[model samples]
Every structure is written in structure tokens, then in C-alpha cells.
Target: MPIYEAIYRSNDHEELITVNSIEQHEKFVDVKNHLYCTYQGCTARLSYVPKGKVRAHFKTWPKNNHIQDCTDYFERMVTANKQKSIATSTMALSDKHIKSVLDNLKRKRKEQESGTDKVKTNRKKKPRPKVNPDSFENTTLNIVPTTGPEADLTSGENNIKEPSVRNRSLINLSDDDLNWTRSVECYIQNVETDDNRAVLELRDGNYTFRVFFEEFFFDNAPINFRGYFEDLKYLVQRHKEYLFSGVGLIEKRNEQYCMLVNRGNDFRIDDQYIAIFLQNASA
Candidate 1:
């Protein structure tokens, strides 16, 4: 459950009452029967102070009751999904944006790291960072221009274009080899997206998964990335159906949207998935 604190209306927004901006929610046993606030239209909290005066409090708002009704329903939906997602992180981008970004990234990165198109040129090595590639932030792509011939050699002009190049591993998935995959197997906490517009439904629960969109998309990926993206897109399209077959992704949502929100986990949005989905005009 998310930690809760007193929030007061401020410029038509729910601003947490804080001592030092480190919001410390007052501890209270969550009473299931009480009606919760509708997040659909209103982000404001209405009092149900007496422990069970929900119907009376709910009556205060006449125009948007469906928002209230959907509150617990959405919460339950999220909770139920969490039990299966084991989300290491969660994000909500539109369905189409997610697929486009992932398909582009996965395809490009696969080809780059796989090196199947590589000509094996004797390019001088550049000073490499010890950090894992997954840790490379959004701007790392911009830095490649200064990193010497390895970056140059990795560029698309270096492609060998062989039919055999289709068979190679992209992304180098070093984390999978370095025990991060083991960590990834478990749920992480609530994630914030890079944008402030959406929310992640189910967070870390039964299964946790993450993929960086920028890293996944690449302009230069050829055979491997192209093949991987196609395979992944197909896999996503039938993810729900494949789960019962014992052979595919466990995620749910429109094929594109799933990819969008799935990548949302990696986005640096207001620091959590819930906020991304719930809040607009976030910082």
C-alpha cells in the first residue's frame, strides 16, 4: 500500500503536507469498506474521518460518482495484476508509443551489440566505462561521437550485410549474466516515469521485468535487431494467449500499450508508476 499523508488543496492540486518534502504518511489501518477518492477526475481527497461514514461523504459529490466507484475497483485491479506482474518497475505510456520505441531500440541495439555485421576492424579501443550498458542514461548516445573508432566502427556504414548476421545476441544483456537478472526475477518498488502524465497499474509482485526503450531502439540495427523486434512484436501480440501455452510473456495490455507501459518502468517520471498514471502536469 502507498504511504499516505495529509494533503491540502493547492492551486487545484493535491499537495502533500510535508515537514521537509520527505512525505511521511500517518499510519492507519486501511479500512476496506470505506469508499476511496475517485482519481479519474478529482485528485483531491475527501474526508471519511469517522471510520465508516463513506456513503455520506460520497454523497458530497454528485456529478462524478463514477470516479469514486472506480477508485477501489481500479485499486483492486492493480493489486490483482501486481500479484502476477512482479514488476520491478511500472510505467504507462500509450500502447502504440511503447511498441514503436521498443521495436526501434531492440532492433538497433541487437544489431550493434551482436556485432554480426562487424568487419572485425583493428580499431583502437576507447576508454570504456566500467558501468553496465543498461546503466547508460538517455544522453549516452550523444557521447558516442567522442568515443573514438569503436563507436565509428560500430556505426551502420560498417555493416557487412551478410545473411548469417541474423544470428547474434543483441544488447549483450550483461545484467542477465551478472546476477541482476536474479534480482530482476524479484519485484522492485514503485517506479516513477520520466514524464508525469500516467500511472503503472500493477507494480512489483509475482514477477518483475524491465527494458530500457532508448537502449532498445537503434537506427543502425540490421539483421539481428530486425529479427528480434519482429519476434518480440509477435510475442507481445500474443502474450496473453502464449502464457497459457507455457511459452511467452506474462504481460497484459494492447500490444503497443504493454510495450509503452513496460518501458515506462524505465522512464524517470515523477519517481513512481502510480503518479505517472494519476497525475498530470507533474514535475
Candidate 2:
């Protein structure tokens, strides 16, 4: 219990009055780390007090009367710190999700090493067929970009081509997996831990686009699709147009984009919307 020396303005005039107390000073400081100082002319000794209590103190003090400017400083600092704390909390959720994914992968690798059957009995292993003999146009997941609110970092711009040619990594899955109607394999393209989304180059070889989200991740994840329905619908419809345009000219130009929205799992937009548009537009 250390004593605090405060210079407070008297109600009658701008003159300062000294208040020496251990209890009152401790009571005024609220934040985890309380910093204190007095106004230019007025000497007010503030202490460890809850914010609510300080507001209550403000009410009793006359608004027109000479009051300590320290209150205003405290309020501003408190507001800024509160906003920072909120941002910190929101970012933590992504950390938890990523940690879970990595943990699951590790667990999966261990299970496989134990000589467990990794493939399901109903599923058959097929060799990678030459869908696009060039091999450059076969990869479904090219680049991972940011999407949604600043949960992890920032949302991705709606672009098809990436900007520059940096270090790029690609993984090609068997074309048979894409053909399978019963099951779909999802590839989640994640940004590096440095908090940057990878840009993807388009099939044109010269042009590239930012892949914010692909159908596989969207279909597999539990998402709140209230606002994302339109974006998703627009994305799928654009690809189907390419698939059927002028005797496969579009597919030859941008590659085949066959998207199937699972109806049973749709939480927001109607799953049939993309299908209906594709059907009508294709004919």
C-alpha cells in the first residue's frame, strides 16, 4: 500500500489542492498497466481505479468546473487498447484452426505408418491419366489466397491471374479423383506462416490469377454462406460457360472447370442455383 500524491483542482477555482492517499490512488487505476501523470496546470493524482468507478466519479464532478485532463487521456488509451485486444482475439481463432489441421495430419501420417489401410475399401486406386498431356494445365489447386474478413490476414481480390512469378509449388492429383461422382478430394491452399496468400498463374502461361478459394475447400468446410452465395454461384457459372462454349473453345482456352455443389450440405444459398444456370446456359 504505497501512498499517492495528487494535485487536484478545487471546485471554487483553477488552483490545485493536494490529496495524499493510498486507497484512492489504488482505486483510480484500472488497466493491467496503469500509467499516470497530471494535467499541464492542474495537478491530479490518479490511482488504480476501475473505469466504471471513474465514470461514476465524473458524474459527481461538475462538468463546468475545472477538471483534470488526465481523465480524457485515460479514456483514449483505454479505447485504443480495447480495439487491439479485439483484433488479437479474432486472429487467435485462425491459429487454433491451423493447429488442429496440422495435428490431424500428423495423426494421419502416424496411422498410415502403422500399416493401416489408408484408402477406403469402396474406393479403387487408379493411375494418373494424361488429362492434359502438357501437365501444366492439370492442377486444380494452383495458388492459395486470402478470403473473408481479416480472420487470418486479408481477403483476396477477384482476379484470375497472379501478378509476378515467384517461387511456386504445385501438386497434381489423379484425374480419376475429379471424375468420381461419389467422393471429392479437397485441397486447402494455405498461406505461409508469414501471413501472405500465394498468387496463381492462369493456364495462358503468361497471365495469372489469385485463387482466394476453390470449390473443394468451400464444399468441404462448414462455412457461413449467407454472403458468399453470390460469389460462389458466379464462380461456378463462369467455368461451366467455358466448358460448353462454341465446341469446347472455352475449355481449351481456360481449362475445364466442372463444379458440383452438394445440395444436402448447402447452408446458405440454394445449391441448385449454379446447376440451373449451367444447364440453361449450356443449351
Candidate 3:
């Protein structure tokens, strides 16, 4: 949780103060002695610090020394995801699932562009397979893909249905939430590319997030996606309003949350397969 307010306790009185309230005064207010964490059940101390470039904000005295449930608490994203993966039987995004989702989106897009509904096929439907509630693969294999306009692209404030595979927004992500693999959504604000790697600066509201694709990732990727960085730049030039949703672990690097695209199947653009869409556009 983004803590805007903190509790101040002195002798027998306890009061609430905000970072903005402290900034309004000409001189810095020294509340380090009395400032307590605003999170309930969290007694960790806080200190106000002014940065040379960014706005002043409260920080835990010992750094991430907050209650377990608090967002600031430190935890390894990889380790947490591994544990959750076992419990949920959730594995990395499979090529079959990715292709199914993208194909579904492409069909919808074509229908929209043509301004026509789907033509009924004369072929008989196959027998439906029974799904196991505890089996992630069995459940997701039948997922009805959501399209660009149909997908819920809003910030993660609403109590959206928490599917077995969670979709998270960087703005509302917490320490506990990052424990599992998440389908994180953010818009690409900028892209930095070099021969070795490419980093996409993403944003959701006022918060900034990043997606990193390294040389190894590109080298191992399929033929169509080897030049993925260039395609991302092309999309930016077109001024297309699109959302980048990558399924990965959210890791904090240099105080910024970043998603490392470890595999090709884990990435998507506006609910469509990244490689397929980029290839079609290039053609």
C-alpha cells in the first residue's frame, strides 16, 4: 500500500500527518522520533527524508521493516512464486495456451474490422472435456480469450475475479501479491533498446514499471520474435493505444518494479500473441 499518511505519537497524544502536510511548511518538520507506520498492526518506525530530485516521502528506519502483510516487507519474488506454483499447480505460460488466446483475439479483431459476425460452421462440435477444479492446465485450456476492448483494462482497484492465474496492476501490487506468477498489465511509455537487451518503461497511473528482455531471452525466442524490440518501437511510432501484459514475477530492481520476460510464451500485447501480431504487422 502507498502510505500517504503516518501516525505520530508523543508522550500521551497521537496524531496523523501526511507527507504533503509536512511539505507545506517552509522548514522540514522533524517527526522521526514520533512517526509510526500507518499500516495497522505495524509498529515499525518511519523517518521523513527529502530527496534532491524526487518528492519527499516516508521510509522505514531499517528499510522494509514492516508487518508481514505490508507492501514494504522484503521477500524474494522467485522463491515466493515457486511455493505458490506448487500449491496452485500453476506453471509457466504454455505455448498451447498462448496460441489459443491469441487466435481467439485475432478472430475477434477480424470480425470487428469486417463489421460482421462469426459465420456458423457446419461441422459438429466435439465432446466437451471434464475439467478438474484443482488442475490449472485443465481449467485454463478452455479459457475464453478476452479481446482488447473487452478485457478489463482498468487499474486494479475493483475486486476483480481472482482467477487461478491472477492479473495484477503495478499500482496496487503488494509484497504478498507478488508471491505468485501474475499477468501484469502496464502501458509502454518508452523503450530503450541496445544489442544486448531492451527495457520498456511502462506506466499505470502515476507509477512506473519496467519490462526487460535480455540477449539470452531474444536468442532463445522463436524466429519471428528475434527482433521483438524493433517491433515494439514500431508500435510506439504508430501511437497505438495498447496494453502490455506479461506473465512473470514482479521483482524490485533499483527501487523500480520490473518484469523479466524469461520466455516467449509469457508475453502478450493487447491480449494477442506478441510474436504473431508483430510478424503480421511487419508483413
Arranged by lDDT with the best first, the candidates are 3, 2, 1
Candidate 2 on 66-140: residue-level lDDT in tens? 244544432211222222212111111222332333344345446757976244322454533333333333223
Q: Point to the candidate with the largest lDDT.
A: 3
- TM-score per prediction, in order, is 0.18, 0.17, 0.46
Q: What is the lDDT of residue 22 in candidate 3?
A: 56
- Candidate 3 worst ten-residue window by lDDT: 140-149
Candidate 2 ranges beyond 4 A from true positions: 1-110, 113-115, 118-182, 190-224, 227-253, 256-258, 264-283
- Find the candidate with the highest TM-score and give its number: 3
What lDDT does the true structure give each of the candidates? 0.27, 0.27, 0.59
All candidates in order of TM-score, best leading:
3, 1, 2
Residue 85 in candidate 3, Cα distance off native in Å: 17
Model 3: pairs clashing at backbone N, Cα or C within 3 Å: none
